[model samples]
Target: MNKLISVVAVVVGTAAALPASAQITSGSIAQNKAECQAQFRVSDLNGDNFLTPREISLFRGSMPTELSGREVIHRQDFISACYATLPQDD
Candidate 1:
């Protein structure tokens, strides 16, 4: 009985260690984009193509959330900087 419980606990722990979906397997932009977009869309509280501070806050509030506030802010800052440097969206 003790051995069985230990085995079950290990299995549960290992399963919990896996990601929600195996889709976002790679960190590459192209590969992760679609998955991230899907997640962003579903998670985007304001329905904005871009995430707002509140929306991001809500995202952080939800579940097994990774990435610190600083990380999110830094990522948003970099993205904003890139967009600013872009030629045109039109």
Candidate 2:
């Protein structure tokens, strides 16, 4: 029936669009992570792999206004949350 064919077409079209959207999303995530990693490195002022309280405070102080107030109790958590506020690289 025409209704069945229309449904199939819609489903197929949607499925085809999904991968493209996913690629875009993943790419943005990757870029965000890269930026956060750079920030983390800069924040690790002592050259240690870990972020100490002083480093965290300094980093938080320098963070953009939007990200300045987020909980940054741990390195991973801080980086992950930074993704939300870090601008996507062109």
Choose the strongest candidate by TM-score: 2
Lowest summed lDDT across 10 adjacent residues in model 2 is found at 21-30
Query: For model 2, what is the alpha-carbon lDDT of residue 28?
Result: 28
Model 2 bad stretches (over 4 Å): 1-31, 47-49, 64-72, 87-90
Identify the leading candidate in terms of lDDT: 2
For candidate 2, write residues 1-90 as lDDT tens digits: 996586456434533454332222111222455555655555555555666766556455534444454444455665666676756668
- Clash list (residue pairs), candidate 1: none
What's each prediction's clash count? 0, 0
Which digits, one per residue and each the tens of the lDDT, describe model 1 over residues 1-90? Answer: 996586456434543454555232122221233334433443343344555565455455421223444423333443443244335546
User: Please, what is the TM-score per model?
Assistant: 0.31, 0.41
lDDT of 1: 0.40
Give every collision pair in model 2.
none
- Worst lDDT window (10 residues) for model 1? 22-31
Against the hidden true structure, what lDDT does model 2 obtain? 0.51
